[model samples]
Each structure stands twice: as structure tokens, then as C-alpha cells.
Target: MPLEFEKPILELEKRIQELKETARTTGVDLEAEIRLLEERLARLKREIYGNLTPWQRVQLARAPGRPTTLDVLEKAFQDFLELHGDRAFADDPAIVGGLAYLEGQKVVVVGHQKGRDTKENLQRNFGMPHPEGYRKAMRLMDLADRFGYPFLSFIDTPGAYPGVSAEERGQAWVIAQSIQRMGRLRVPAVAVILGEGGSGGALAIGVANRVLILENAWYSVISPESCAAILWRDAKEAPKAAEALKLTAQDLLRFKVVDAIIPEPEGGAHKDPERAIQNIKEALLKTLEELKGLSPEALYQDRYRRFRALGVYQD
Candidate 1:
């Protein structure tokens, strides 16, 4: 989907078409003038995308064409073998994890998968996992560790499913188990917040030796809207909550909540998804390489310190 700012650019292109039609109809020479107008339109698009506001960035991150978890798997992984089912109950499409090859090395890839359309959205629960989904992640993660394959998780959920079925299935317990298992996993693990990383749904897979986030991806304990609802009793106050939550990649990096921020294309990742995937692939390769050198003791020490060091008071 095109950004609202792109509407004017599209309108300009339409007008350029009208000019060409008028020139053709009247037998007038306007080719040179058309070229000039086209060049100006292209330059205007570049300028508009160069300095997008935070909210606009958010809109782009959730855009329909924005790269999904499966899209990244296709671009960044080779020989992916999808593993399904929690082994205890039904398979949840909201969380997908399996074996894949990254940079010629075997690895486990897991992520929250959102649907591309309305019917699929209902099927995937809009990327919000239930207890079984988290349970499945734990099973895959355990397999990765047992096989000595590094783990990579892409977080892009609004939150875990809060419906009665999810609660009945022990959603909180499953999420907590995932967090504990991920943190204690002996193999190297990296997490990237590809889009909205909200609440425990994100945190379950987020504990890692290295955490990367796209420039526009937001990670927060509670979503801005949720925070606004709790604090102000108005969802319309989300913008203010977003500002205070400091959930943007830049803010999280500055606060030492994540290891690094992956640069997205101007106008966010949806602008050019291949480039975005390339950035993530490069970051993941670099992090995996770095983690390979660390001993188990060092990995545990540093990972523990990384979490403990957050929220430190500095005067």
C-alpha cells in the first residue's frame, strides 16, 4: 500500500498523463516538458520519503505489503524445513518455527506470522499466539539447542491472544516457560523485532544474546494504545504514550534495551522489502559469528548482565 504522502505523487503522475493526452490530441510538442515534470515528480517522492515522521513510520511498518515472517524466511534462509504442532495439542499458525539454513549454517528460525488478508488474519489471530503457540516455540527451541543449532526469532506481534481459550490453555505459563528456556538455552540465540513487539507475546522469544530491531519496529512491555487506555482512559492518547514508552528502535538502542538497530529503507521496510531482508540477514550473520566465539559461561554472564543493566539509575 502506498503512503498517504504518495497520494500527491500519484496525482502528479496522473496530471502528467493528462498533459501527454492533451499534447497528442492537439498535435503539440510537449515531450521535453513531460520529461521535466517526470523528473520533478521523482525528486519530490525521494524528498518526501527522506524525512518521515514516527507515526507515519508506524503506518508503513504495518502496511499490507510490508515483508512478513515468511517473506523474510524466503529471502534470508535456504533449505527451510517447517516443523509444526506443539506435540500436545493443535498447531497454531500464529507462531511458525522450524529448521533453516542461514549463511550455509544450520539454524532454527521462529517468528510470529501475521496474515496477508482478512480471512487469513482470522486464522492466524492477527499474529497473536495462544498458549499452544508458545508451547510449540519452546519445543522447536529445545530441538535447536539439542542439535547445537543457533536460534533466531523474529518478533512482530501486537500481543498474545487474550481470549478465554488462550487463558484456559495456560497462556501465561507457556509464555513464561518460553522466556526461561530461551534465556537458558546453551546455543547462541538472536532476536529481531521486525514490527510491533508488544508485551509477553514478544518477550517470550526476545531474550537472547543479541537483539536487533528495525528502525521503525516498536518494542514495548505494553502497546501505546494499551498504556493510553490504562493511564488516560482514552485510546486516542496513544501518540503521547508512544512518546513516553520509548519503544522505537532508536529509543530502545539508546536505553540499552537492544544490542543494535537495523536500518530500514526510507519510508520504512515496506518501501523495499528485499533491502530490508538483506539488512536483517547481514545483522544476523554478524551476530551469529560474534556469538560463536563466546564460551557458555561468557554467554550466560553477558546475557544476564545485559538484562540486569537495563533501567539503571544514572544521575
Candidate 2:
């Protein structure tokens, strides 16, 4: 199903299809009319997607069929040897990590993995990691540091699991540990916000030398719906809260929260997954190339300075 804001675009597309079918079946020459509608469609896409509000971008980030971490691993990298288990407890499916080759350069990749449907969502816990998940991520970071491989992380979770079981197992502590681990890694690290990037779940693996986000992705401490519920006592006020939170990619880029924005295909990533993943591949390779010359100590200092400079205020 198309999102509410996308209905107009889809309706126009449907009309164009109908006209094409009519012309084909009735042997009518509608080439001129079809060409006009095609031109209008291109302009409509730019007008709508190019001017998306923060809330609309959020909707796009959460849209169904948006490419998942596994999808990127498959399409953007090669020879992904998935590693499981945190070595302390059972492995958490919400977080996935492995060794992969990016344009023939070995790297360690870790990310939150959401599912495609309700049954799989339940199994993946809606991409909300538990303590073990963060631990697993830390394990991968350690591997990267040990082998001098660059680290790549994908951020795409609503938040860490908040249930009593997760808490009992030390969710917050593990998250903090993961953030500290990523910060201290000697290898170059880069993180991309593929989707939601909500709260500690995203940040646990997100501390890196360069943080990038997709054009339609968002990164925030809390989701707009949750913020609206808390601030306005109504979830329906999420659009207003979204504007106030400044979580969109453009907003984050303005604030220097993200280093760069990878442009998505028209409509959204789900509309053209291959193009979106290819964009990510190019960005990652370019960023890694930029970081290639820095020594390990230089990389550490670079990351330290980058983060220490965040949120600086002027009187």
C-alpha cells in the first residue's frame, strides 16, 4: 500500500498505465498524450519528494520494503561471512555482523536487522536489540581492531529492547560498552543510518570517524510519535513533533550530526533498492579511501576530535 502522501503520485501512475493500456488495446495513437503525462509525472515526483517534510521523510524511512541491512550486505558488499554469538550468551538475531569485502578491501560490518513481515518481525524483535546484540556488535568491533580491517556499521533500529528481560541482562550497560568499544577502535570506522536510527540502539554501533545517513533516513534520540505522546499527550501530533525534533537527514547535515547524505532513488529506497544500495557502495568506498592514509593513532585521534567537537555552543 502507498503512504497517504504518496497516493497522488501512485494515482497518476495508475492513470498513465490505464491510458497506455487503452491505446494499446484500441489501436489509438496516444503517444503525444502519454509523453505529456510522463513529463508531468517526473515533475510531480520532484515536487513531492524534493520538498518532503520531516514527518514525510520519517514515513519514508519506515516505509515497508525499504532495503534492510542484509539487503545492503548482499548487494553492496561481497563474501559476507556472517559471525554469530556474543561469546557471552546466546546470539541475538536483531543484530548481525560479519566479515565482508568492499571493492576487494576487507572490512567488518555490523548492523541491526529488521524483518520483512509480521512473523519475521517477531523473530527479529522489530530490530530492537537486547544486551547480547550490543555485545555481539562489540565482538565484531574487536575483530576489526585486531585485524586492522575498517569497520562499517548500519543504523536501522527503533531502539534497544526495553523489556524487563533485556534490562535484567544489562541492556543499558552493554549499549554503553558498545559505544565505548567503537570509540576506542584503532581501525577506521564508518556508520550509515539506513533507516530509523532511534536512540541508543542506533548509537551503540554508530560511534565512528564518519557517520552518514540516507536522504530519507532519520536519526533521533526518540521517535516523533513517542515524543508527541510525551510532549503533547497525543500521538497524532507527531508531524509537529517531527519538525521540532530536527531529525531529518537535511536537518542532521545542517547540525553536523551526520557527515554526508547518500541520495536515494526517486520515491524512496524501496522504490529502487539497487540504485540506493549502489549509492551506498560508492559513498562507503569514497569515505574509506579518504581514511586510508591516516595511521591507526591518527584515526583514533580523528574520531576523538570529531565527537568531542559535537554540540559545541557559542555564547
Candidate 3:
């Protein structure tokens, strides 16, 4: 169920609909009243959304209507040229990669995609990549390297596909190879966790010079549900597990897991997707500008240090 504040927003929408029907017969000046109610509802939502718990933020991040990779692609990139096939197997829809323009800057774009509807979700394997998907991503990484174009990746997935078919084709090997190849790629690369960044699936393309995460998005070594099931024998303990995971953007930055956190609008990126995209655009432009001048060898050394320095402890 949605929160209490959402009820008034729903009610106001219902009342507006009824008023519209009544207007056909009574010719009443309901527009003013409807607008006022809408404004009031908006204020109420802002109040409720102002202070959200970690769990509430998690809910917002996984909201079904949240924007996907394609949504952001259409918004922030132009002149896209999609490449196909892993040259080893069939094309995998779970991973999408191609060349595109980021504010007229030629760049290689890649991301995990989870479809919005049932059929599409099934087709996308619930955003879990198979061996072919990882291979395809590595192919694109090579393309980006050869051309000297900056690489941009979006991370969003539960995990890599764990089905028999995927494993039969060596899923683990492909994922590891992707990361291994990325570490040596001679280019300025940036990775953003736009949604769920689960396990090695997210890590496949996350090796980069600058890693950015959305304020509510999560990036974790293992998913909370997976950890709960293993530890407590109940997936319902995921909430508690999430508290221990420290996967949120701010937490990730504090742990030295990522370079930066991109703030979302009030509530989260879903509250206003355009605003979220704009914020991401600004961050990417800034990072690219900052890293563009570094030599390829310098970029590689920095990327290695960035990953090596994560989650250190000293006594």
C-alpha cells in the first residue's frame, strides 16, 4: 500500500475526474477549486516526502514506474548507433550498448535494462544478463577503447542470470572477463548506478574512473534478499539485511565504493525523472570535463587505485 499522503493525491484526482463529468451538465467554475486542491495535495506530498526512511527510499527506488536505461538514453543522449551481437553468441537484450552523443560529445553507452511490462520483462530476463550479454558489453568496451571515446555505463539489475543455459555458456567467466578488460581500457570511463546494482552483474561494467550513484539507488556485493535467505532462511528478513548492507549512495561514498553521489529531486528520481536526468547530465559533463585531459595511462592507474582503495580498514 502507498503512504498516507498519496491517499489525498488519489482523492484529489478522483474528485477532479468527477468534477469534469459534472461540468458537462452544470457548467460550474470547478477549475479554480480543482487547481487549489491539486496544489494542496502537492504540498502534502512534499511534506511527507521531505523525510523518508531508508526502507521508504528503497521502495521508491524499486517503484515499477521508475525510469529505465532506455528512458534515460532518449533523454540524455543523441545520434545513437546501436551495435549488435557478442560475436560468440546471439545478442542479449538484458544488456544494451551502443555509441551515442552526450551533449554532442561522442561516447559509448551501455546499461542493464529491465522492461516495464510483463512480456518485456520476461524478454529482458528481468534485467539479468547472460554470458552473451557480458560478452556484448566487452565488445563495446573494446570499441570505446579503440576509438578513444569516453565510456558511460548505467547499472541496474538484480544480478546476472543464474539459469542453466547461462551457466552452461560460462556466465561467471564472461562477467569476470568484462571487469578484467575494463580495468585496462585506455579511456575516461564513468559508471552510474541508476537503480539496483546487484552483485557481479553490476560490477561487469562498473569498473571506471568516476563512479556516480543516484541518491536512492543501491550498489552492493550481494542483494539483501540473497543475504537474508542465506543467513536467516527467510527472504522477509531483507529489510534488516538492507540496513546492514549499506548500499545507498551516501553510504557507498562514505565507504569509498564510489567517487560521487548525484542528488535526486525530493522523494527520489521517480518524483521528477527529467530533473534526475538533468542532474545526471550535469554530473557526467563535469566528470568528463575533469578527466578528459588525463593521459590514458594515468586514467588506468587512477581507476585501479579507485577500486583497490574501497572499504579499507586499519587498526
Candidate 4:
């Protein structure tokens, strides 16, 4: 389904398609009309996608059929050997981690995975990780450190699970531990925000030397709807809240929250997932190469400085 904001473009495209089909069947060249409509379609796309607001970008990040972590694992990496179970409890499908070969260099990859259909979403908890999920991520990071392999994390989650059962399992504590573990990792670490990087769930595996985000992805301490509900007592004010939050890639780039912004295919990653994944692959290879030159201590200090310099304050 096309998003509400995208309806105009889709409608225009449909009209252009209908015109072309009419010309094909009737043997009358609607060449001039089709050309004009095609030009208009191009401009319409540029206008809508180029000037997307934060809320629109958030919608794109959560767009149905947008590439997920599993998609990247299958396409971006080679010879993935998935590791399961947090060792203390059952495996959590929301968080996937394992060994993978990136351009022939071994690395540990971990990310939040959302299911494509209704059944998968129910199983993956809508990409919201539980306590065990965070634990599994930490274990993967530990493996990366032990083998002196670079750590690559993909962040795409709304937040950690907020259910009573999740809390009973120490959701907050495990997320904190995961954050601390990422902070202290001796191996080079890179994190990519593929889509909705929200709250502690995103941050748990997001503490890395280099943080990259997709052009339309968003990363924030809290989701806009939740922020709206907290401040205005209504979720309907989410657009206003999203504007205030500064979560979009452009906003974060200006704030230096992200190291680099990987451009997506025009319209969004879902429109051309293969190209989008290739762009991410190129960025990852470049970032990993840059980080590989530093020693373990240097890598740790680099990560420390990068995060420590996030916000501006004056007294």
C-alpha cells in the first residue's frame, strides 16, 4: 500500500500508464501527451521525495516491504552462519546475530529483524527486542572481540519490548548491559541505522566507532508518537513532535549524531532494495577499512570520543 503522502505520485503514475496503454491498443500515438506526463511524473517525484518532512521520512522508514536486516544479511554479506539462543533463555527472533563474511573479511553481524507478513510480525514482536535479544547481541559482540573481528550492527527497531513479561525478564538491565558491552569492545565496531532506530532498543547495539544512517532513516531517543502522547496527551500531534525531535538523517547529520548518510534510491530503499543494499555495502566496506588501521586501544578511544561529543551544552 502506498503511504498517504505518496498517493499523489502513484496517481500520476497510474494516469501515465493508462495513457500509454491506450496509445498501444488504438494505434494512435499519444506521444506528446505521454512525454508531458512522464516529465511531470519525474518532477512530482523529485518534489515529494526531496522535500519530505521528518514524519514522512519516518513513514518511509517503516514502509511495508522496506528492506530488513535479514534482507541485508542475505544480500550484503556472504556465508552467514546464524548463531542462536542467548545461552540463558530461548532464542529471540527479533534480534539476529552471527558470523558473516563482508568482502572476505570476517565480522560479527547483529541487528533487529522485522517480519514481512502478519504472522512473522507476531513472531518477531514487530522488531521489538526482548531481554534475551539484547543478551544474544552482547554474546555476538563478545565473540567479535575474542576473534579480533570487526563488529557490524544494523539498527532497525521501534524500541525494546515494554510488556510486563519483558520487564520481568530484566529488559532495561539487559539493554544497559548490551550498551556497556558495545562501548567496551576491543574490536572495531560500526553501526548502521537501516530504518527506525528508536530508543534503547536501537541504542543497545548502536554504540560503535562509526554510526551510519540511511538518507530516509530515523534515529532518536524516543519515537515521535510516544513523545506526542507524553507531551500533548495525544498521538495525533505526532507530526509536530517529529519536527521537534530532530530524528531524521538530515537533522542528525547537522547535529553530528551520525558519521555519514548513505543515500537511498530515489523514493526510498523499498523502491530499489538491490541498489540500496549495494550502497550500504560500499559504505560498510569503506568504514571498516578506515577503522581497521587503528589499534584496539585507539578503536576504543575513538568510539568513546565520538559518542562523548554528541551534544552541545553551555553553562
CA lDDT of 115 in candidate 3?
Answer: 89
For candidate 1, lDDT tens digit of each residue in 1-315? 566866888788898999999999999999999999999998887887766655555666678867788889988999889999999998999999899999799999899999989898899999999988898899988898789888899998999998999988899999999999888877888999999898899999999989999888888899888899999999888878887887778878888888899998866788799999999999999999999888766777767877877796768
lDDT of 1: 0.87
lDDT of 2 by residue, 1-315 (tens): 789998888988999999999999999999999999999999998999889999999999999889999999999999999999999989999999999999899999999999989899999999999999999999999999999999999999999988999999998899899999999999999999999999988999999999999999999999999999999999999999999999999889998899999999988999999999999999999999999999999999999998898895787
Q: Estimate each model's TM-score.
A: 0.91, 0.98, 0.88, 0.99
Q: What is the full ranking by TM-score, best candidate first?
A: 4, 2, 1, 3
lDDT (Cα atoms) of all candidates against the true structure: 0.87, 0.94, 0.86, 0.94
For all predictions, the C-alpha RMSD in Å is 2.3, 1.0, 2.8, 0.7
Task: Compose the digit string of candidate 3's lDDT tens values, residues 1-315.
Answer: 455435666676688778777876899878887788778867876776775655566677777767788888889888777887899879999999899999899999899999888899999998999999989999999999999999999999999998999989998999999999888889999998998999999999999999999888888888888988988889888878888888777788888888899888876787689999988889999999999889999999999988887756787
Q: Which model scores highest in TM-score?
A: 4
Residue 35's lDDT within candidate 3 is: 82
**RMSD versus native structure for model 4:** 0.7
Q: Give every collision pair in model 2.
A: none
The 10 consecutive residues of candidate 1 with the worst lDDT sum are 51-60
After superposition, the stretches of candidate 3 with alpha carbons farther than 4 Å from their true spots are 1-44
Better of 1 and 4 by TM-score: 4
